[model samples]
Target: MDWNELAMELQKEVSGQVLTREPMARHTTWRVGGPADLLVIPDTIKDLSATFSFAADHALPVTVLGRGSNVLVRDGGIRGIVVKMFRGLTSMTIIGEDVVAEAGCYLPFLARAAAVHGLSGLEFAAGIPGTVGGAVVMNAGAHGDSMGDVLVQVEVMDSSGNLTRVPAGLLQLGYRTSRLMDTGETVVKVYLRLRRDEPVEIRKRMQANLARRRALQPLNMPNAGSVFKNPANASAGQLIDRCGAKGLTVGGAAVSEKHANFIVNKGRATATDIITLMEMVRRIVWDTFQVHLEPEIHIMGEG
Candidate 1:
């Protein structure tokens, strides 16, 4: 698709950096993936819209990425255009009991901001390593709370560059999933409804949640948080551990001993290694408990 020429054209159309054959590894937390055909990092909502329009005109597929925390890009990489929303589009505002955040704003940072503003609902997000858009799409949670609980609405951009404001209820948010997962629409902004609280108390709760996450998760290594979602009435981690899948290895990937649901990259792990290990763990848990564990992390790209 003459990606280099397309990259040049896209750069001229949008106020953003455009690159050809950019490595997907550089964008994801797991740091294991091949190169993308084209990568665009937009500077503003206008820039993002222009890029989307350009892609639509060219009939190129678009893949949107947030913090890349809960994704696994395959080793064969991604085709078409990959739009990364991080350094750009991260403006946030707090008004009364509500917070308005751009899609790229880090979830943890938003949680801290809410606490600073004496808000109570986001303390559970203090340790989640994703962006607001990603949190909403995946219904990301920690400490028994999720984005679905506080989200009011979101601004999403479709492939043809049309933007719409969708209420949280319309998203059908449930158990680490939402209708957005299949829509190919990109979340541009988020509106959250939080309650006023004592700042000191909010920070205290956030601190406790962060501490618990640090103690329970494999934060020391390069990992994509939890690999599998808990089945109905069952913990995916406990089931995997019960099946003796912890510490099991496939190439450079291994099930974390501290948390069975995590597959850590023990230096030089490939996407294939992580995926193989996940399958092995899934098979073992299914064999032992007869519960089918579903993936919480989004798997993308080719292969």
Candidate 2:
């Protein structure tokens, strides 16, 4: 019934690492978050399912985390059990012309795998900093391509710890959003259908995308990729730039001058600072262009 009793039981049934009061800041991309009361990393699907079953049975709140690329956690920290899928769940297999990858497998690695196998269509993910599971949930994309374009089917584990393979049609994926976005189910595996292309051409395209990202993004700084989604046919960065809000700062958080949509942590930036800056940018863009900007990054925990 107590926290330690539950954790010890979890340690016995789950084949993964478990830590108490783990700092979530170490897990997120922005490098700013409070502690998680409990954190568990499951290596494989079976372990994940076991963890979930335990949580369900014990009535403990559960939060799933992938690579923590597009998320920000507040200073008050997250309560309950935080499950992170990594390493053990990282496996990719080529099945004929399709690729079956585990949830924890990094996006860029999947892109590289596709290129090596002469599979086209994942080139857009070459520099993405997320995992397969996160990409599917958010329909993450770049250069006019997204996970929905090539995803055929995915294996997901529900809150009850039941694994189900669902078709892409059931996912309701569209423009950086998916039905899975709010669903509590955890993506355990993903299957992608891609066309055969010359490896040389695939490599060339991947390299080009990577180069473009490096040139545009403040890759040197700690920040979530894109703070806001593109509005209609207009770019969020362009709108922010036009408003002269670029380089706007609140505490240690500042809107990236390299690309206005990104807000980087200048070092020791708190969640409140980023939130304040985002609010300012949104208000400025709305006032000037009459366009409402929505956040792309997931903000969690409490300040």
Candidate 3:
């Protein structure tokens, strides 16, 4: 598709970094992926819109990513254009009892900011490793509180680069799914309504959440967080553990002994290894419990 030529044209169209055959491994948390045909890291909203406009003009496919958590890019990498939103759109402000954050703001950092501002609702997000855009799109949650609970509204860019403000209710946020996932809209900013609380108490709660995550999750390893979603009233991890799937390995990917829901890269793991291990665990859990486990993490790109 003459990706180098497209990269040069895209660079001229937007004030952002444009590269061809950029390594996807460096962008994802799992640290394993092939090279993207074209990648753009926008410096501003205008840059993002221009990049999208360029893609549209070229009739190219587009993929948007932020923080790269809870996502696995395949070993063949992604085709067309990849827009990375992290590090470019991270601006946050506290307004009265609400917090307005840009899409790329780190979720953990936003949680800490809310605590510092004596806000109460985001304490559960202290341990989540993702960005506001990705979290809102996926309805990400921890400790029984999801992004749907506190979100007020969001600014999103359509595939054609048109911007609009959408209320939280319109997002159809439910159980780690959102309308944005289906619509292919790119979230730009998020508005969250939080209650005022004692700063000391908020910090205490955040600390507790972080401690629990540290004790339960495989935080030291390279992984895309939980592999499977909990089915209806049952925990996915408990089911997998009961099926004796922990420590199961396929190449460099293994089900984390510390957390059955996680598949960690021991070292030199490929996307194929992770996907193979995930299917194996899914089959074992389904065979034993008769529950069809669904993936929680987003799988992207070609095999």
Candidate 4:
């Protein structure tokens, strides 16, 4: 059967919002990308499982999105089903020194929630714009701390629709990657171990982190946080700056003048523009310093 036939059958089998030819730009941070064959926003774990099962039965490929902060969807768009665990899955609970966060919970929201409950470990994540699930998949971090530092365990659903809880050690988190991205298991819940601190102190630290980010990042522009990862003990932004890749432009995408690592969208920037700019920066930096900058953002969809 064709995708339209599968969509019609899925509408009857699950309780979730389903859309065909959904524009990827509307769901991504960069605001660029074409359409997906199918987009499903599951309201609950059962609904998500059912959707996955339906895809499996149809032999359809799957792409799961978090809060869309660290991804760049290509202009050609994605094929098959795109599953987004949002809205209904956004829940947080404080259990003593531990915080239980649903996958859809945004990093900043989760950090604020933990602070309200007198938690301290999440203060470092206050400026990270991705979701808890996305953070786990990429081991997202800033300053000197990271998600793996506070993560106790993660509950994930396999592609087979089976749920499993994996410990932090087994997650293989390092720099900006985790095993989850390669394994393609859907992050459902996260258990975080935090410290009890004065709410005022926690908020102050969060504010400090935010202020630092503001000073170093292009927060006023439309762009993902960092385009490239730092290599070894060196900084990616500093390297880009040294190579004079800053202020470089490709179409409507240009490296942020404020920060060399960020490639900002100049209003009408397309996915191709962003990708082209990134490639240009990589090539220049490599030739100038013999150091290749690896991309921090996840690029998805077809070519």
Q: For each candidate, what is the lDDT?
A: 0.90, 0.90, 0.92, 0.89
- Root mean square deviation (Cα) for candidate 1: 1.0
The segments of candidate 2 whose C-alpha lies over 4 angstroms from its true place after superposition are: 1-5
Inter-residue clash pairs, candidate 2: 43-88
As for candidate 4, its clashing pairs are none
lDDT of 1 at 20: 95
**Tens-digit lDDT track for model 1 on 159-200?**
777899999999999989999999989999999999998999
Cα shift from native, residue 213, model 3 (Å) = 0.6
lDDT per residue, candidate 4, 92-158, as tens digits? 8988998898898888999998899898898889998888988988999887999999999999998
TM per prediction: 0.98, 0.97, 0.98, 0.97
User: Tens digits of per-residue lDDT for model 2 on 89-166?
Assistant: 898999778899999999999999889999999999998898999999999999989999999999998987788999
- State the local distance difference test value for candidate 4: 0.89
lDDT of 3 by residue, 1-303 (tens): 888888888899887789899989899888888888999988889999998888889888999999888889999999999998888889999988989999989999999988898999999899888999999999999898999999999999998889999999999999999999999999999999999999999999899989999999998999888889999999999999999889999999999999999999898999999999989998898789899999999999999
- Model 4, residue 125: distance off in Å is 1.0
Q: Is candidate 3 or candidate 4 better by TM-score?
A: 3
For model 1, the superposed segments whose C-alpha errors exceed 4 Å read none
Give the Å shift of residue 122 in candidate 2: 0.4
